[model samples]
Target: MTRPRLSAVSVLTFSALIILTGCFGPPAPAPTSTSAAPTTTAAPTTSPAARPTGVTSAPAAPLSTAAAPPSSAPASPPPTEEPVPGGLPEQVAPLIIYYVAVEDNGVSGPLIGCGDSLVATTTAPVRFTDQVRPSIEALLANKSRGVGLSGLVNVLYQSNLSYAGGELTGSTITINLTGQFMLGGVCDIPRAKAQLEYTAMAAAGATSAQVFVNGRPIDEVLSLT
Candidate 1:
């Protein structure tokens, strides 16, 4: 029955308080960091309306509206004159052209004498400041139809006649003529009224010329038989 033991300095002070609680035991919880804190994974943020999956971009150019085309008006200079060395310029001249003389050697009958069967020829020159429209366009261009083989005979040659123009006023030169003024016989109505009134009065040196055919009155279209 003798139970009172424990005292080797209280069992060495309870064995140094159990060796200071196993050498400060609460600090053992710090080593439980299972290696996870270094995982910062936040660098993947790119969100500015995010567009870069397989990369496709390229569709912008489209602004034109249309409306620009109006600049065109600069052209006026043309009138200087002064330079004439070779030919054609001293105010040109020459352009007579008349015909109908066949007085026998090649007689085809009937024109007894419309001012003794006309004559004269000349042509090719023009511009004495415009000689009465080029001498009635060289008597309607019958350029002396071979001067009727030298005897003369432009009874308004081929007579499909045209020249519908002339005026000359002061000395009176009307001419005008259009077409269909025929008369191949019956002395071609006074040799076509004396070859268009002596070729419009020697081409408007006019002492009077009144032709008109088509407006009637080259003596009523040559009905003077």
Candidate 2:
């Protein structure tokens, strides 16, 4: 009796499902969460004993331990003086020099002035000055050589002549002599006087001479001789 109830509706529904599967297969499989290719970051480089502390070095000081010295100025020089015009007076002492004179020509009637020829070695280089004493010393020593020099060949001789000192004025020199120095004989006195005068004036660069014996001027002795 139920076999007679079968219908087309149920059969059609089953056929529609079959047709959807044939047209489009089952949905694609769900996508899985896969890891990306590993990243390749470079590691940061660092100096030994230095890192994220970020500490830095300090600047060095210009000078070490030592300090500089203080400055000072130099000293000043001394002042000087200018010299006088024509220079100073000349005076040289204790020198060796010739005692100069002229030889006399007369034997009698008293000799007058000195002549030209010299008794060259009658006196040696002796300590000289522009003074009378030194001159007298030299003259006497030469006279002491006897006969051929200050003394006469036969008629006279000059002995024991002595000079004290002298003073120079203008072109003349006044010489002081000892009294006994002029106590010589007549003819010899004049010649001796000539020698004394010439030597002294020559040394002093003077042209005339005046004599004083024992503080007495020899004008009379000169007149007598």
Candidate 3:
């Protein structure tokens, strides 16, 4: 018998068949992969009080708004002093008296007797006539007869008069005179008793005459004599 002809094709065919059979065999039971059952971790437990609530906290109370204390008011200004009259002292009162007679030719006689007195709250009556009379006589002597008479009468009516000597006080003045007068060149009894009251108030050191006639207010008749 001739040895079976070993052809290259037949040899190759048998080898291939073996290789395929091995490859098709069920894949070796997949390696039993039991990844140690993932280690089970226990969740942390919380008490009911620890649970987070959705509510937010309220704001604190507002600060008090009490007003600041008020500032004190400024003090008032001091009162102003009044200006004193001219030709007079700062604090003095005057009293004056005049005596005159009408001449035959309608002229006025010289100032015969003149006097001044003063009364202060804490002191006795002060008579300044000796010092005051001469000055008053000089004033009368210088004036014309008509003016002198008028001026004398004016002086009598107006009580308060301040001159070189001092001041006089009291709201009223009394005059008693006994003299001869001539209306139209005839001698006549010019005796008169007159009482003068000051209606207008006089300042402490006023020099001018500021009095009224008998029972008459100063405003009614301001005639100088």
Give candidate 2 regions above 4 Å deviation: 1-122, 128-132, 142-161, 182-184, 221-225
Q: Which pairs clash in the backbone of model 3?
A: 93-167, 93-168, 94-167, 94-168, 95-168, 154-225
Please give the ranking of all candidate structures by TM-score, highest first, separated by commas.
2, 1, 3
Off by over 4 Å in 1: 1-93, 99-102, 105-120, 128-132, 137-189, 192-194, 197-214, 217-225
Question: Model 3 over residues 122-207: C-alpha lDDT tens digits?
Answer: 11233442323333323223323323323333223222232222234454222111221122211111211111121111222223
How many pairs of residues in model 3 come into backbone collision? 6
Candidate whose lDDT is highest: 1
For model 1, how does the per-residue alpha-carbon lDDT over 1-225 read when each residue is reduced to its tens digit?
999997788998989988998988755555555766543333333563465564444555998889877658775679779876663344776777666765542244324454344666776656665465666666666634457457667766666777777777898888777776555676656666666766677766778788887787777666642
TM-score winner: 2
Order of the predicted models by lDDT, top scorer first: 1, 2, 3
Q: Can you tell me which runs of candidate 3 are displaced by over 4 Å? A: 1-65, 70-96, 102-105, 109-190, 193-225
TM-score result, candidate 3: 0.18
Cα lDDT tens digits, model 2, 1-225, are 556754699778889999998899888887667846555543344653553344333345677667756557665666767766572344545422232233544433223544422232233344433445665565555543244444433112244446777888999988887745433454455555666666667666689988887777776656655
Prediction 1 global C-alpha lDDT = 0.65
Query: Which of the predicted structures, 1 or 3, would earn the higher lDDT when compared with the native?
Result: 1
C-alpha lDDT of candidate 2 relative to the true structure: 0.55
Against the true structure, candidate 1 reaches a TM-score of: 0.28
C-alpha lDDT score of every prediction, in listed order: 0.65, 0.55, 0.33
